[model samples]
Target: MTTVFRKALGALPRLGVQVLDLGPGAAVVSRRGGYTATKMSGDSWMVGGKRPRTRTTADGWGLHKAAAGDLCARHVADLLANYEVNCVFDVGANKGQYGRQLRELGYRGRIVSFEPVPDALARLRKSAERDPEWRVYPFALGRSESFEDMHLGWKTMNSLLQPSAYGQRRYKRFTDTRKEQVRIRRLDEVMDEALEGIAEPRPYLKMDTQGFDMEVFAGAGRRTADFVGMQSEVAVLQLYEGSPRMNEAIAAYEDAGFAITGMYPVTREKTTGRVVEFDCVMARAAAAPSRQG
Candidate 1:
């Protein structure tokens, strides 16, 4: 039924709802008003009546172009299947869109969502209101419980754990409207409780914690072994400053006994050049007994 639903959704007529500028970032629009879509446009277009810029869409969803950094809608579904995901850690969840995308992809397993922005968190909670398994965590994910200065942008751009926030600090200048001391928690801090709280025997992690991908795993510690795979939104450019942050992530997984199997470019190829951004890192868990052996 879900497959049929997805197909039906896929079969519906699509539009060239390209992603437009949210001033500093991108957003998706339905040229047909948030319904089904077909061939997306190759050029940049505006949404919410804003000016257009370079944009792209996911492979399947045809629902206009979206600027979700490296993590696109197609990647969202791909991660759901690729990881054989049971439980997901939707870190840096903005308005529960990541979780919604996964659910829309027929991911029926548990979803543990976390978001930091108070307003965004509220919307995230409201989005998850009907679902029981989709647990929306309201807090900032980071290296620790320290007061990490997070820049909250509008829409999906609201992130302290993403490259955009870091970029907002580095490249762009903005005056922060609301700043609060959010409780920054590590993954390891809530693993036992979180895992016990969900349905899966062992859950996979889908981390899009802004640019703080590495530190979340670091916080995961030894319990990181419990995950089957990971799809993280890594900040390869800003955080690593042009070095391979993906390789660094692989090393972290290796240290934790996981292997980096596949990588997905987070950009929509239909747009433009090598200036592509984002990668969904898929790491498979090492055999437990063999690791001990």
Candidate 2:
């Protein structure tokens, strides 16, 4: 590849363009909008029109980063498309970030988001109001139906489990700032009710409940078989009290008949480069005995 072509390929993610290799010495660039840029030999490029404005939100940046690096969103898109997923259970959906990213990535499935934090839920509701297929629920999913004290942090760090001492020291922004009493329900109890009568619902569950992913899974019960894939935030360090470590989290999911497919780093300790937490994607293992007859 020429230096210019290499640079363009390297910058495509930040530029929000998808490259299609035509052959040696030529490629096509597809952008978010309907415009296309063609790269020819010797630093030569051709564009049909002016470039569209790029997205600047954190979710947009993450999606583009994944697109650039061939990471999380790419795997997610593949799972959704391959499984023909019709429903998405977005657990711990803060401000509908995951749902929004899904739509941007071409997922047209029905989305049911559960968020218990008052402020976050409000924003989530507004974000999904215009989308008829996207529904927002104002409750958390746990091991059972009950009320719990949720520790609220600077932003998305809120969780049912208390922040760990390591978390507080390593990341000051994750310090528990306040507590809120929130209603919690089990996925087994709410899944059918929330997605009643959806035609052939192949659900993809995505959880970002901070340290409470296992509790959420415990509540899923036999309903786990109904899901085609699941994505959860797995902690490397003990970010929250009672939260499972990376190995433990993987083991729990594996025991549930899912196999690890992808791991996307979410945060890292700035100095030591130790992973803080990452998103783990799992699909039902093919070798596992079929739940259906």
lDDT of prediction 1: 0.60
Please write out the lDDT profile of model 2 over residues 1-293, one tens digit for every residue.
Answer: 36887777768868778775555567667775354445433344444443348733533444333332245776788778877788999999999988998998789989999999989989999999999999888999999889989888668878788778997887687744788899999999988877787977788889989889999999999999888889999888998899998899899888888888888777755455566788899888563235432
Q: In model 2, which residue pairs have backbone atoms overlapping below 3 Å?
A: none
**Residue 132 error for model 2, in Å?**
1.0
The TM-score, computed over Cα atoms with residue i paired to residue i, of candidate 2 is 0.75
Top of the candidates by TM-score: 2
lDDT of 1 at 288: 29
CA lDDT, every model vs. true structure: 0.60, 0.80
In candidate 1, what are the lDDT values of residues 33-139, reduced to their tens digit?
53222222333332333323543333322222244432355554555565556688887787888788777757888788888778888999998999988888778
Per-prediction TM-score, please? 0.64, 0.75
How far does residue 97 in candidate 1 sit from its true spot (Å)?
0.4
